[model samples]
Target: MKKIKLIFSFILVLLVAISCTVEGINEDTALLGTESSANLNKIFDISTDNSGKVTITPTADGAVSFKVEYGHGTTSSVTVQPGASTTHVYPEGKYTVKITATSISGATTEQTFPLDVVFRAPENLAVTLNKSIHNLKVKAKADYAKSYLVYFGDVPNEVGTPLATDGEVSHDYAVAGTYNVKVVALSGGVAKTEKTTATIIYNAYGLPITYELATQNYGIGGTFGGISTAVVANPFPTGLNTSATVWKYTKTTGAETWSGSYSPLDSPLDFATGNKIKLLLYATEVGKSLNVELEWAVGGTPANGVAVLKVANTVANSWQELVFDFSTIAAIPANAKFTQLVFRYDDSAKGSGEVIYIDNIRLTN
Candidate 1:
């Protein structure tokens, strides 16, 4: 009986040894050899470009897959195969980048690196100014900027105000003068800025017009009949009191008329007496008979009272200021409020392909 008991104990010991060996093989373990540790630092490299784009390249012998996580809120993990690279774009801020490499045996090694991203300057920035009574409406556009800082240049020590892309802001100028405008683009906390200047003028007598104010409630080039008008740099010399740009009209073979219309005046223009219409005109030929007409509204509807005036171009190939006396032209109704202005060339008498320049059309009391 003692011999039988010893045999049973030997069998039990063999079974226990087998169970321990199986458990050791199946347990969760990690593979962190010297080669893997050294490769962990060498396999992963991170870099950023001027536009704040981040790229990560991983290269290791035993690495099977890679996982990268951006530290921002709700950011997802990026996975890539071994010997491959991944890229991501980040805002202007500092972030922690965590990268993990997984082996064939499900062993993972991770490393956290610091990344600093800075914002680039805004691109395609533009500003449009619209003038009104005692104020200027400014609109700005920047395609690449997330936010903006607008400076009206009205007061001192103005830190500026924040705006979004293609936003509009306004400033009130007490009198006519030159003012500075500055715009800044921001991403996260980093900023890049730009600036421009504006000149303001007030006309108290009549509806004022200038190159800068051409787009303010006004329309140009109507019924050209194959004529083209280009807004280009003023070709005239200084002291002509012309704005930076002038309207150059090129007539085609079938060109007949050129007209510019404005929005309805706030109040009816009283042209029954001493008012006159003035404009800067440049012609290529002398003695070109021209007919000028003003169309306006009566009681908020189109009126029949069209003021037609005749003028003779005595100066040839020179810039001259032309003033049409309303009193000398056809009689206008006492209640007529002038709004639209039309200029018709001598279609039957003028040559084809003739060019003319016009600027700064205004009215005077």
Candidate 2:
């Protein structure tokens, strides 16, 4: 009975050992027989900031690791695991990319893809030019532009000034004239957009004659009639006429009653707004009459001349503001294009060489 029991136990142990060996062999075979890599694909994300940066993510059906050949003159390839991405920078051109995906069983599949790294030209380019006397300010904006270059056109062979996307550039001309201004927008590559404009640089004489800019041509006109006028330093820079310079009028003895001074404007005045003219005056006596006249240009007939008379009621030897309302005159047309401004003081009366100061001549509603 003891021998039978021992034999049964031995048989059971042998059967158990044989079953474990067979299972181990099957597991090893299964591990070595993994499916080959298939369905190799990739996604590319290219940057728009002109940095030439590209992110590549590779995908495959049974891939455990991937080797990427950027094909842009790179010596070594990039190795990435499944579901991983790699970044590379390339110049503007076309290239081919090679991807090799490997499975757990050491089987690999290779695929090739075409890549294009082209920079598009900038679009919707807008340029603005602001002129103040001889200085010009330039501003530009566009889409897909990395930088800007401005050519003021005043210099020969201009290298152009570098400007940022949200910045402005200014240039001062030595002499006033018309110039062609050019601006170029770059895309960090060979792609570019350009714009050209004819800009006028001059001292524009218009309303609100402040007499501040030294470049302005404040040419005096009209009959002096013994009244001499000059732009001099403000002798009485007090009250409302505290400016650096003022128009001085000296009515000498034996001066005619029509003694006046006039200045020609650059363009015709538009009376679309209300006809009101204001000027700062410093007189020697009160109750003095001042006349403001508007006349046609040299080519126009003198029949369209218009005048408005106002009396000074403020204290003497002090600055005072006087408003001349031409609207009160019904004979003057509303759409008159007046180009000359004439100033007369104490018309139809004799003068004893009294001095008067004038400043801040402007139009108001």
Candidate 3:
């Protein structure tokens, strides 16, 4: 009985001692000396406090100390008494952290923990053009942005392909007409297309238009030639007044000037009734003048000087358009078309070498 009692008591004492002892403490009854490195190292220590925090105290070699792996991802070690704590905030990612414990004795151990991190990308893109369509020569407008690409369509108003890579582009329609315009943008690997209506209108007339020249002396191209002499007959032939083609120049001299290739219309020019005419002239020399006149084309006939126009002395070789307002012709007996068109030069004065060319005689209503 005594032996059995002794054995049972010893077992009881061992159980009591074991139960009273704290985890990680040595069995020695000696007081804890300067903090130990071993006590400071705990990679992941479950805590009575919430919010993941792990603390490691440094060894006797120095203050509690430790480092983290994979970029300071895990908690560092700190040395202190029991139940002390620290915290670490880890960003979401795929990484591993190493928690190490070092004793004053220069011994160290390490542990690692895997971390998980995840995220989502961006959204779809939208694109627009300031102006989708415009006239040929007019400028179109487009606004710019990142990720989103804007594209113009082949036709107007239709959604086009990706354009961000290309930047804002312009299209000119070939003909004068209407067209559809479009704009599309892409973003975040997604394509978002938007469109607006546009038009190209051309209402203005094109240049280089054609016009008709009217005159009895008028032939296609230029100048009147090869016609019979209406001069001696009726200075003004019947049928040409008020036409875009007829006009007359009078002799500044005695109605007749050149002996060759030129002559007056008729002997009588009824300037008294209301006759109008225009002429451009220059002088050949002192005392000399070139008179351009319209009269009956008969030999030795008196010349009608009333319709003549002249400029003398300068002979500068300049030209001018002389207009005539024949509001009154007392009585035009021939019912004439005003058909006689002539260029007359009078050398009756000392200046004989003078010359003048006449063109473009138009009479309008």
lDDT of each candidate versus the true structure: 0.64, 0.83, 0.36
* Model 2 spans with C-alpha error above 4 angstroms: 1-35, 47-51, 69-79, 87-89, 203-365
Predicted candidate 1 versus true structure: per-residue lDDT over 1-365, tens digit per residue: 99999999999999999999887765634223322412663232333223456676755558788788877665699888876777776667888878787877666788887777776666677777776645777677765567777887778999787777667777777765566777766543465657576655343323555556532433432544556666678887445644677767676665544432223443345555336878778887887756567676455433444476767777766777888777654455444566555566665543387777777877675
Candidate 3 lDDT (Cα, 0 to 1): 0.36
Q: Mark the regions of model 3 whose C-alpha exceeds 4 Å error after superposition.
A: 1-162, 165-167, 191-193, 201-205, 208-365
Candidate No. with top lDDT: 2
lDDT of 3 by residue, 1-365 (tens): 99999999999999888877853365442334433443333334433222223333222234344544443533444344334434454332455655565444445555566543332222233333342222232222222222232333345554434444435445554444544444443222222334444544332221111111211112211122221212111222222222222222233322233421332222223434334554332222333343334444233233333334443434333334445444443333322222233443444432233344334333333
Window of ten residues with lowest summed lDDT in model 3: 206-215
Candidate 1 colliding pairs: none
Candidate 2 deviates by what RMSD?
A: 17.0
* Model 3: how far residue 66 lies from native, Å: 16
lDDT of 2 by residue, 143-231 (tens): 98988999999989899999899999999999877789999998878999999998777675667777775656665355578888888
Candidate 1 whole-model C-alpha lDDT, 0 to 1: 0.64
